[model samples]
Target: MNADNNLYQLYQSIELENVILSYKGEFTSELLTALIHILEAKMEELGTDFRVRKRVFNVIIECFQNLYHHIDFYDFRNEKLEVRKPALIIVKYKDGDFIVNTGNYVMTKDVPKLEKRLSFINTLNKNELRELYLEQLNKGKISSQGNAGLGLIEIARKTKEKLIYNFVKKDSKISFFSLKVVVGN
Candidate 1:
């Protein structure tokens, strides 16, 4: 299809998916805050119940923070990209469930470690997840990026869904890491 037609097709898909918010760019603290505000307003506009909105809001924050912090981990290495490619993020409400997804580039070598982590988290039940969260919290380990390594656990605990993730190799050196979390009744 032509470029315009391609764009139109993607737009139609997004609308049909009931996407509430979408952004694909470098995320900064200010931008994250702004996005949260926009989504909160959108939820209010849709008359989302207070409790549901709160849960969805918490998951969105964790997702955005994970995206933002992980990006900088490779900032020193990925500077050679064509023009500092931006990451992709989308939030949609479908079939009464809120889905948040984010994708960013990662070094191919690091994919295994991340994939393993998520795989383990997906195997846990709600109680197991709660236990793991507490264990990590008590350990008090912090990465150089100031992350306590609890974002995924927290997201799982809040959403109570198996995080859907994929790593598509973009080139010899880099891959695109995509993650999806769904929360609903």
Candidate 2:
């Protein structure tokens, strides 16, 4: 399709999906702080309940951190052009519920482990998720980077919904991992 047509198609898709906010670019701490303020203001303007707003904000933080910490930053020097940083965040509202979606690039080798972790989190009920979250928190299994590994569980517990995710192969060595969480008003 032509450039204009492609842009129009993207607009149509976002509208169809009820997207309130969408961003795709590099993730920096400064940018994330600004975005969080913007999101909070938007949610307030939209008359979102405090509880739901809080849940969405927390999930967004977790998703953003996941992108920042776990993303693979392999050099693509062989390519002539700079690849768009494979990071995206979208917030959509429908039927009194909000859905937060995030996408980031990950090493292909990590996909299976991630899929398994998400799958297990998805299978847990609220209490079970809470238990796991606390267990992990108490165990304090810190990574070299100081991550406690409770992000996914906390997202699931707060949203009270199964995490939805998909991994699409971007190349031989990397894949795009997308995750979605929904919060009801």
TM-score of each: 0.90, 0.87
Give the lDDT of residue 100 in candidate 1: 89
Identify the candidate with maximal lDDT: 1
Cα displacement (angstroms), candidate 2, residue 19, comes to: 1.0
lDDT of each: 0.86, 0.83
Instruction: Give a tens-digit lDDT track for model 2, residues 24-52.
Output: 88787787788889888888888989999
Clashes of 1: 0
> Per-residue error at 132 for model 2, in Å?
0.5
lDDT of 1: 0.86
lDDT of 1 by residue, 1-185 (tens): 59999999999998998998899889888997898899889888878878778888888888888878877767766667665657888999887788988888878999999999999999999999999999999987898778998889999987847889999998888899999888876
Backbone clashes for every candidate come to 0, 0
Give the runs in model 2 whose Cα sits over 4 Å from its true position: 72-84
Q: Model 1: which residue pairs collide?
A: none
Q: Cα RMSD (Å) per model?
A: 2.0, 3.1
Question: Which pairs of residues have clashing backbones in candidate 2?
Answer: none
